[model samples]
Target: MAARIEIEGDRCIGAAQCVLSADKLFDQDEDGFVVVLNGEPDGEDLEDARTAAMICPSQSITVVED
Candidate 1:
């Protein structure tokens, strides 16, 4: 199973920390806000996704086990 990823738009402060940490699972929108490229992260990506969540300056990233 993969992990469910979520990003709170309002909480995002245009920081690309998540992107830097997990480019495979995250990206930035036109506005520079963080976006979840993959809602369900694979086993290997799951760790990166979780790291992205912690690396997020605005704490906008969320990973839920599905």
Candidate 2:
């Protein structure tokens, strides 16, 4: 199954771990909060997405199974 990304904006603390782990699927807004770049990415991207969620400092990154 592919993974889908979800971010809780209020919980984000401008940490870039998500962006650094999976830049193709995550980015930061002007306020430095997380922004979902690709909601659903398959294959290796899915793995990276999970990594992003794991490394997130604020625990705002959620990788949903699809």
Q: Model 1, 18-57: lDDT tens per residue?
A: 8888898888888888878888887889999889888888
Q: Identify the leading candidate in terms of TM-score.
A: 2
Off by over 4 Å in 1: none
User: Candidate 2: where is the Cα deviation over 4 Å?
Assistant: none
Q: Each candidate's lDDT (Cα)?
A: 0.85, 0.88
Residue 65, model 1: lDDT of 80
RMSD of 1: 1.1
TM-scores of the models, in the order given: 0.90, 0.92
Best by lDDT: 2
Model 1 lDDT vs. the true structure? 0.85
Model 1: which ten-residue window has the lowest total lDDT? 1-10
Q: What does the lDDT read for residue 32 in candidate 1?
A: 88
Evaluated at residue 17, the lDDT of candidate 2 is 93
lDDT for each residue of candidate 2 in 1-66, tens digit (9 for 90 to 100): 866788888999997998888889888999989988899989989999889889888899888895
Candidate 2: Cα lDDT at 13: 98
